[model samples]
Target: MWPAVGLTRSLYLKELYVARSRWRSGVGTVLMRTLFEVAAKHECSRVEWTTDANNPGAQRFYADLAFQQLPSKLFFRADATAIEHGLG
Candidate 1:
């Protein structure tokens, strides 16, 4: 998780992954709950993450945890080469 600049100090979760064999277990829930606990400890305003649209399981998991989908926003990636080229 990376902290955002501002009074609220929001956090952005880069990614979350669990072993395929661990599916249907409570590990994901526990992991998320722990992440929230950490965010609370740091007084973070919110925690954000992104999942591929192709991964319905992940999407459902986040939705079950009350994470709203921001369909209006789009996620972009800038690799090292792209950045080095100053967004060409």
Candidate 2:
């Protein structure tokens, strides 16, 4: 679900999904367009989302909608280095 707020120039799509059998049947397009329209109604000038790096299908889907790939950053935290040294 996407969050709805007062009219703004930015839009964010938290998540979207379609049935596997319905791929390329215009459902995804319609869903995106509808979302865009909703965003536009709220004065949103941009729509954005994130997908897993290994999800080629999702990547292609977003690409078809004119979404350009942007550089990303990831961070991880680890602790207790000795905790796993002797334990399997």
Model 2 TM-score? 0.68
Overall local distance difference test of candidate 1: 0.86
User: Highest lDDT: which candidate?
Assistant: 1
lDDT (CA) for every model shown?
Answer: 0.86, 0.79
- For residues 1-88, write the lDDT of model 2, one tens digit per residue: 2333354467768788999999989999999999989977877767777788899999999898888787773534356885557546
lDDT of 1 by residue, 1-88 (tens): 3446565777778888899999879899999999899989998988888999899999999889888899897998888988888943
Task: Return the TM-score for each candidate structure.
Answer: 0.84, 0.68
In model 1, what are the clashing residue pairs, if there are any?
A: none
**Candidate 2: Cα lDDT at 52:** 82
Top model number, TM-score:
1
- Candidate 2 lDDT: 0.79
